[model samples]
Target chain A: MLDLPTRHLHGPGPSPVPPSVLEALGQPCIGHMDPAFMRVMNEVREMLQQVFGTENEMTLACSGTGSAGAEMLMDNLVEPGDACLIGVNGVFGGRLTDKARRAGGVVTNLHADWGQSFSRTLIKEKVAELKPKIVCFVHAETSTGTLQPFEGLADAVHEHGGLLVMDCVTSLAGRPVELDAWGVDAAYSGTQKCLSCPPGLSPVSLSERAMEKVRSRKTKPNSWYLDLNLVGNYWSGSRAYHHTAPVNMNFALHEALRLVLEEGLEVRYARHRRVHERLKAGLETRGFRYASDPEWTLPMLNLVSIPDRVDDEAAVRKRLLLDHHLEIGGGLGALAGKCWRIGLMGHGATDEAVDRILAGLDAVL
Target chain B: MLDLPTRHLHGPGPSPVPPSVLEALGQPCIGHMDPAFMRVMNEVREMLQQVFGTENEMTLACSGTGSAGAEMLMDNLVEPGDACLIGVNGVFGGRLTDKARRAGGVVTNLHADWGQSFSRTLIKEKVAELKPKIVCFVHAETSTGTLQPFEGLADAVHEHGGLLVMDCVTSLAGRPVELDAWGVDAAYSGTQKCLSCPPGLSPVSLSERAMEKVRSRKTKPNSWYLDLNLVGNYWSGSRAYHHTAPVNMNFALHEALRLVLEEGLEVRYARHRRVHERLKAGLETRGFRYASDPEWTLPMLNLVSIPDRVDDEAAVRKRLLLDHHLEIGGGLGALAGKCWRIGLMGHGATDEAVDRILAGLDAVL
Candidate 1:
């Protein structure tokens, strides 16, 4: 065994996978099309729908990570020359823009500051003007740890004849994501983030309206591996042979989703919020300020500015990891060097995990 | 935990994972950017280079199944309108054709019978005629269990100033895949096959020449997620942040690759051959005819026609799974219902597994 380091995963994601889920992951490998494994797939689908708060029949896990789900949604719904209005605030939204353009969509990006959420009124205006085939937003901007509220934006996009596609990669299961009630046409998330599963399978749900758009596409999706129609058939009734589904990964996700439902969504969200509040108070006492806007800060992914007393942020982080065995994310892109992202997500969202990070920070500082 | 019915996996892929690797997978989930995990990634790269028998520094695991590797290569290397002459024999070859088309390649399919290898002269003639930019072939077609000799074909493609790309998904560790010796510009495989890990990660290697072609692409590859340049940067020295990699899956692969190297490649290949021979003798005694071409049949995956006596093949397979807890693959596409595909891959390619399958088949018969 390659030196199994005991890391307190306080990073963006994989946020400390639970023991039961890990046990589930280690289950014997079986055929993807096996009847028994198929039952696990069916259960996983059912659980994913519950977590996503969607009644859509097209809910299933894609074979890759969160970005694969992002690519899948864009590749399937946004055909060549189809107009897409994307909210660009952080890394994930920028990634959406890139994915949409790659899928041959005529993309119009509405920019927001990295640490701030998109202005709902601005998106409404853009959607009304462009009347795009799809309106894309990142519900939780992981890079900047900002949560964009989609209260009125969904209705505005749908009214303008656009499908509402949201990237809930960092928010699903840990936050409120009412897909059916909020009128989300499509949404996708990674298992690692809030689900606390290893980062492989992507839990995705699509509304009937989104499926209709995908089915009516003028051409096949850009990547055959991520084509929703092919993957969906394998997940749903037809069970057609697409690529061999990741069997053990599915097993892991099945148990992770089970744990999520077992804990209950409302309780899970409250736990995240509780830990976030504790961490926020702890950081404030230690002279750290929230990097993301206070009004839109994500409960799970807390972005904080490096304190003035810390001369070398990298050195401090390195020492914390080396001495304390705590792993927190250094910022990405614009936030690099200026901030550190501390995640209290899924199984990591506990007073114990918060205490560990806070104690590690105190020691390092 | 979900009921994980113990199965003796003899499917085309997702061969039974060993206990140690599963334990490694169950190890504590860490941050993808953690230094310890980075070390694992580095070791995986080094071991993959050895297994592939290639000096290509670009070797790394893509974050998906075998088919994701297919799409990545097609999307990155096969530019829009570039002539690609693809060999079509089984489901994998057909998949390659679809992926290449989606990547905007001007595809010219050279068809061979499903259970037969492509004619060297025909491929040579086609290459000379089309002088395509990329010459694609499946090194081992899993659907038909036929091994197409890539020897001499690489020189032919290179002579026409083209690159050779091979799909070695089911052939990698169990078979002799001398990527550098054969002068293959690019190749991809799955962990579930001969590696006998799980089915999420795709181990891919690209020659510098192939990377150059990818670098010179006019448009970004059709996928932002599977973009080789970005993923490669993460694996190589820069270690740029890409997607949150499947952390525990990488751990599983790291241990699996260690196991592969410990056994040594030649010993592993011989073991697969030894079990294949034993299975072949038992199968022949039971009056099962090899469906794949005898001269080129893959030792790892044996595709054999069900005997005349077996009227309900599906019932026999179901009983084998339900009663004896042994699982083998049914034929796909053209060979469906006509044949049964039995795999002796990776950790599952053992005398014990072979004996178990044989006994189960006899009991069911």
Candidate 2:
């Protein structure tokens, strides 16, 4: 067997998986419907609801990556010419709009500058004009490390008789996501991000309103695997087998959820916040400026402006990988080469890991 | 963390993973581009090529389950109104046709009875009439445990100026695929089946001509993550990041591939065949009949006719699960409750497992 390298993952998602989670993942494989595994699966659902802070019955992990969740939500919520409003401030928001359009939805964008949160007034104006069936936005934009203020946006969407679908891919475990309290009809996140599991599955939840819309959808979902109705039934207590659950990955996710619960959601969130503050302070002392303002910054993934003299962002990333065994992310899309993404997520948010990254950066600089 | 129950997995695809592969899967998480992990990834690519018996450059594993590979192949190969021909004899074949149609392909089926293989003459005749851009078939029909002949079909597809896409999901490591020798252009298989890896990734390989067609596609693939051109770059030497790979799962696959290579391919195939013979003999003693003709039966997955007196297949399956700690598959689609699918695959294809299953069946009967 080819051997694995020991390296601390400091990238956007898939932070260092704890040993307990790894042991859970390596457990004996079980049938998707085995009573024992099903018990764990059901527990995972309840635990995820606790993390998402919602009581959505349709909540469960999709068998693919985070993007698959985005596509699944779009496929179920929108059909041909169904008006949808998307927040487009960073790479993930652009993806949401693209997926919405691909699903035959008429998409209108509430544009914001990269690393800048959308103004509540602008969001209100867009909602009033488009009055779309769904108002989609990212709670924490990983690409620019900006967290959009969703309280006003959610209220605006609801007032206009629209549902709010939020992308909490980077924020769910690191920060509070009040799905019920904030009126989010649908939300999706990755296990690898703040959840600190490997990156193969996406945890998604839908509110009662969202489930009702799916129940009353005009078309059969375009994709079979992502069809939430069938998937929901399979994941529910009925335990009807649909597709083969990624058994090992699910085991890892179950452990991840267990870890989050044991640590206490509030404690874990505070841990992430503490690590973010330490890392940010260290980076600033070393002459770095964050792309997002302090108020809207994501605690897990930090976006920093690249110095002009850097010249080759890829080379610097390569150096970090080779010399320090540190894997930081590069800016994506329009922000490429101009910003770097340093993540402090899940297990990687520990103080030692933060110090290691800072020490590596000091040596490199 | 929920402890995994020790159970024997003799189901359709997510067969029991070997202990070595499981151990490898639990190894610490690493960056996808870590030099050590990259070496493993490269080795995995090489091993897949060896098992596939082709030097195709685009051989790599998709992050989702096997069905994702099936969907991705169709999404990349077919466009709106493109004429495509599919063989429909069992559940998986029907699914292939359904997915193709959903992807906007004008699908024509070469019909065959369930639990039976089609004649080469009939298939060639049907393909000539259809004049399709792509001709799809399943090497092993999991639902019916039928092994269809593909050598003649591949030649016929080439003669008609069409590429052949084959689902080797159940056949790859269990039987000889011979991609180049058989003239098949594209093939996809699940890791859980014959490789003894947990079900999370599907290894797919595309011939040069098939990839060229994908590269020159008229429209963007509906699913962004499944797009071959984009996903290939992630696996290619350039190492452009696309998505966070399920790192631990990839480790499991690498070790599984090593096990396959260490136990020679021919020996592994012989072992599967031997265990299948033992099971067939035991089942015959219990008054069971083969669902398909012996000549066309797949050794990896066997379909047995349900007895007339024994009704409620669900009860029997449930009893098996509860009493024996064993899991076998039931027939899907039209054959539900009519047949039982007994899989001898990966780690499940052992003499001990077969003996235990037979002992349990004696009580059920």
Find the candidate with the highest DockQ and give its number: 1
lDDT of 2 by residue, B214-305 (tens): 99988877667788988889898588777768788889999999999899899999999999999999999989999986899999999998
TM-score of each model, in listed order: 0.99, 0.97
Candidate number with greatest lDDT: 1
- Candidate 1 CAPRI assessment class: high
Error of 2 at B101 (Å): 1.4
Query: lDDT by residue for model 2 over A192-224, one digit each (tens)?
Result: 888989888999999888888888878776676
Q: Residue A11 lDDT in model 1?
A: 80
lDDT tens readout by residue for model 1, A1-365: 87967988888888888899999999888889899988998999889999999889999999989999999999999988989998888888889999999888899999888998877778888888999989989999999999999777778888868899999999999999999989999999999999999899888899999999888777898888888888888988699989888888999999999899999999999999999999999988888899999999999999999877779999988988889999898998888899999999999999999889999998888
Checking candidate 1 for backbone clashes, the offending pairs are none
Candidate 1 structure quality by residue, lDDT tens digits, B42-69:
8999999999999999999999999998
